[model samples]
Target: MARNDVDLLDLSLDELLTTTRTVRKRLDLTRPVPRALITECLEIAVQAPNGSNQQRWNWHVVDEPDLRAEVAEVYRSGMSGHQADPNRATRDIDYSTEEQQRIASSVAYLRDHLHKVPALLIPTVGGRMDEADIFLQASVWGSILPAVWNFMLALRARGLGSAWTTIHLHKEAEMAELLGIDAAKHTQVGLFPIAYTVGTEFGAGARQDLADLIRWNGAG
Candidate 1:
């Protein structure tokens, strides 16, 4: 393949780092994301740091409309019990009421429209960590998360956007069957919706003062 379908946006490292928002409402659900572009991002993503360089990650990109619809149904089923209070998970966060409401609205929108997104990515690792010790769990997850984050960054650089979501994992077994994922052997990281952004303009998100969260040398 020629692999020239999309052009990578010219973004400095800092700009790329700060502006890759968790896109939900702004995702261009009507547009199609080429598999080659997803592969291009994965090529850059797998270069991320991992434990012992084992590289035991698998990237499952679902672009087929029927499959995507099935996955979205599973995601919806996972959220059905909680839709009445979508912001329940953020109740303890430090964000202001306005910020919280904004998050809730976006989350609700994604829940409703996830089936419309062009593609869904579910990255998995080699081992089952549900009963593992903290050390093993850390090693397993540490190996895949950076690569996933790298994939997200690469998506942002190419004008696509996604949000890391785990709501579907609540029904992981059902999802595994639907996708034929060997749950006994692999652990899913999260679900990501991939598509071009409605607009390419985004700004840094608000956060708490670093001074309040950072430490100098040791626990103060």
Candidate 2:
């Protein structure tokens, strides 16, 4: 059996949790992510918190050239909407900072090169949630998100990087068709392009301070 625990005292658990940035342009598209590593990450991921211990995670890992191209096209087709949005075009103006500018430019780079990445992962679950009640919807997604987060964390620990992208979820059915997934039965959670980082020097990104966001009691 795979070990479920990492040695917190030996490993920089806090740093890993904090610095696993949403890697984009920095992902080394040229380097092939080893199949063993991907499997290892998934192994680690499956141990994440789930509802009723029912492990419902399903993965469609696209590594073949032809399928990658098709998936990328499908992802891009959906992305065109965001690309055409007026507000998105002016997002740089909304966040005027060197870091934000770098983020914007890198996002554009990924938009152009997503297909070329060494690996594309589509994480899914057994149930569809479109018409499900709030409880069912939350339970379904809640079971998957922790596993996905664990997968990302495992990848970062192994020097691999991937950005979780929801843009492709807009074309979920199309992607499901291409990947031979029965969309009626399974819900595609998101897309992730997996590759090595050009240089692994991640730092925490800016965020709202805990003090500002946290409240001692219920909403005022």
Candidate 3:
């Protein structure tokens, strides 16, 4: 069978990096995401390295109406506290007046209708690590972080957009029960909403120069 062709390497480093945005209100909530495409993306995700090659990762994709609603409820429930927090800031990233308005509008829309998005992905690990200290926590989470990133990159290359969200995990046990996630067996890492972006052209965001972040063996 002939396979579809596209130059993966041809995508400039900047383009690839810039396009991977944390999609929220810009997600095409009306369009449906086909299962086959999601499977293809996940196939790419598994190629990411796992700690000690354990390969013990699981992904749960929710598309059913009732389930999506349930997940959204969990997400909304978690978001309520943040929304109520007095210390939370509402500054916009875009500098222009119109751009700031647009950003604020998108955020408002997502907050209002997050439950209606097409799909949700909850990635999990097969085993739990003892939380003795920071190192132990890092060792367990380090295993899944790479694979999670690969999943997001694959989604971006395929014209999908997602945002890593742990807010819903605040009520992890409830979410687990609703999704039939075996929390006793697998560790739920985070939740992400997956959908085709309303637009594919995202610009590079502002970042500090490497010199400001990098350090030599000894501080100057």
Candidate 1 displacement at residue 28 in angstroms: 0.5
Report the number of the highest-lDDT candidate: 1
- Cα RMSD for candidate 1? 2.5
Model 1, TM vs. native? 0.92
**Model 3, residue 45: C-alpha shift (Å):** 0.5
Preferred candidate (TM-score higher): 1 or 3? 1
lDDT string for model 1 (1-220, tens) is 1266567777899999999999999999888888888899899899999999999999888999999999999999877755556576844676567878799889889999999999999999999988899999999989999999999999999899999999888789999999999999999999999999998988998899998999999998
Q: Please tell me which model should have the higher TM-score, number 1 or number 2.
A: 1
After the best TM-score superposition of candidate 3, give how far the Cα of residue 168 lies from its true spot, in angstroms: 0.5
Off by over 4 Å in 3: 1-10, 83-107
Question: TM-score for every candidate vs. truth?
Answer: 0.92, 0.88, 0.83
Q: Give the 10-residue window scoring lowest on summed lDDT in candidate 2.
A: 1-10
For residue 73, what is the lDDT in candidate 2?
A: 93
lDDT of each: 0.90, 0.84, 0.78
Worst 10 residues of 3 by lDDT: 1-10
User: How displaced is residue 75 in candidate 3, in Å?
Assistant: 0.5
Expressed as tens digits, the lDDT of each residue in 114-210 for candidate 3 is 7788888999988665444787678668888888888888778767889887777667788889889888878888888889888777777767898
lDDT of candidate 2 at residue 1, scale 0 to 100: 26
